[model samples]
Target: MMKATPESMTDADGLEMDRCFSTRGGVAYVGLRDRWPWYTKRRSASWPFAELRVADDKIVISSMFGKYAVTRDDVASISRFGRIPALYDGFKFVIRGDYEAVVFWALWGPPVRAAFVRHGWEIVG
Candidate 1:
């Protein structure tokens, strides 16, 4: 497993954001992208940032609260949560084991969706 360091972390634009994690009340979060502004306001919680990275054969999410990595073999399906252009079009990642599903929210889901597809992961929805 490769860990993200300040010199290695980059944003969607390929530029270094310097900060690799988001923290609130002592907990940190890392994912593809943090929650949308509207979603964050509605949720009433500050910490939902997720840092998603695709490894050799797995998807890794690192967060201050918890970290999990799901390999291609453990993935059951990847589906779209809602129609495009909605408030937030999110993607759902369902794992085959006892792990719970993970959903990533954003106005645009194609970028990350493409990343998963490129890794030969299955998309059921």
Candidate 2:
């Protein structure tokens, strides 16, 4: 397997990802676009970011940050598009395609939570 180097990492915009060393003890959570992901993050230099590989008969997501890997069988649904309208302000909508699969956002706040509920998306505890 080819390993990802700092110079080879790029964002969805095709721009090279900012190589920032974590100065504190925590994770930098983010979401990927045009992929089967709801949320993601980067923590520490050794942590895995995002790597897609094949295992078994399905695609497997090998997350770099931790020992987290998700296969197609493990996924409930895959979200193709999502939008959090700017006009809606605090409101956000994360649509998923998998039946019984859940979409999770990193923000955990009452206002954001209520906004999602208003849009008919159930918030999992």
Candidate 3:
């Protein structure tokens, strides 16, 4: 699940502004782009947070573990999955390389598509 800091950052429509609007990468970033969402394994383990940033010629994924760069040559394959039957659908991707990294997000399709397109990554799935 997505958690927010200070717990009162929703928009007027009661939507989560922090989660829905924050952009870690791309050219035209808008909304509450201040906070990065934190991902935890359980309730006790250390949180692993990731941010996508567009470098001069590559897209970078920086996280608690390490950093990975996705170039134009890298292939991005996407898959949809969820723990619940239909309530928590999310997307996951694997970038193939020696330093391959998998990223998951609860974001909808369009934004995810736009991110890949903007970075010139080839979407294979």
Candidate 4:
């Protein structure tokens, strides 16, 4: 297995995913396009800002700092993350590769949650 050190590790990139997965319709996303993502100071999120995109059978998030993406197979579980509560209150998708992401249930939360439900994924909370 490939070990990724924090210093050497970078967020998932979907730039070449089109050739592997059907990067087509059924797309949905949320976040401020103007640089702020409602609240600030998040670890799993890209620095400065971040936007989440859900499409087909995958999820992609990008910001000025980096990008991360995962498909159905990579997801393991979903649960509540209350590190900051309320504004940051959301569900997190635990991925197989020790990767997880937080998606606020308020920022287009219904649909974001629906995207995973459509795939019959998990919601541990």
Candidate 5:
């Protein structure tokens, strides 16, 4: 497995993987971790966590494993207060929208499915 290093700074998905002390326009991508379960297993998933450019007022959330990019405008709804319960030891953030949420629902497992169902946050596909 490849570790984060100056030489391997950029991940296979073309995202910066270093967890630097600070960045200029860094903001959370939201739902990235949940989208890709194999992230930790693969070194490619290390990048998106670095610094993300919220291009066009939209957040392009790539799957945790860095396989695909989840579209932003497809969001149908957000948490009432923009908060979701902890998924990965309080490190993960859940942001439910239309397109991405639907994809999430289809991809999530039994517990996640049950939780999302209880939240009444599903959007029709």
Candidate 6:
């Protein structure tokens, strides 16, 4: 369980490094997230869809519904998981909120995971 140190800082890349990711320019990573009614509210499962990025000390998740932001200070930990649905490999970002955000692994997963680890966030496999 690693933690962010006082000296740790994001480089010129903002949050996730766009150049290092498989995602298009200006985005850190691309992954699936809760859509529309969201997974928790549905009787049948809907496919996850979203984009992940870091900006101004907040982790931002952008979806068709809009964007959700979690401050870096609010994050408790990030853990890797593979549950339900085929290829559901994802990570859960636990924060000081009533809900936690789930990011499904994509072509962007590996590099972003490495980036988060490098960022000194508490990342558990």
For candidate 1, lDDT tens digit of each residue in 1-125? 98988777775534345522222211122222343531111121122455566544656555544555567677776677545573455556666754345555644456656766666666666
What TM-score against the true fold does each predicted structure earn?
0.53, 0.24, 0.41, 0.46, 0.23, 0.52
Off by over 4 Å in 3: 1-48, 73-100
RMSD of each: 10.5, 14.3, 14.6, 12.8, 14.2, 10.2
Order of quality (TM-score): 1, 6, 4, 3, 2, 5
lDDT of each: 0.51, 0.33, 0.41, 0.46, 0.31, 0.49
Best by lDDT: 1
Separate clash counts for every candidate: 7, 4, 0, 0, 2, 1
lDDT of 4 at 5: 57
Error of 5 at 60 (Å): 1.9
Q: Write candidate 2's Cα lDDT for 9-123 as tens digits.
A: 8544333444311111112324445556644542322123433222222322223344232343454433322333432122122224422222222222345444334434343
Q: Which stretches of candidate 6 lie above 4 Å from their native place? A: 1-49, 83-88
lDDT of each residue in 1-125, candidate 4, tens digit only: 99755455333553333222121111112221235553333444322255555555666655544555667787765665443443333655556755234443333344545655665556565
Residue 109's lDDT in candidate 4: 48
- For candidate 1, the 10 contiguous residues with the lowest summed lDDT are 38-47
TM-score of 2: 0.24
Cα-based lDDT at residue 8, candidate 6: 58
Write one digit per residue (lDDT tens) for candidate 5, span 50-109.
332222223233444332232344443433222234522111223444122212211113
Judging by lDDT, tell me the better candidate of 1 and 6. Answer: 1
Candidate 6 C-alpha lDDT tens digits along 1-125: 98855345444334544322223111122232357543241111123456666443556655555555667777766677553344444666655654535453544356666756665555688
Best by TM-score: 1
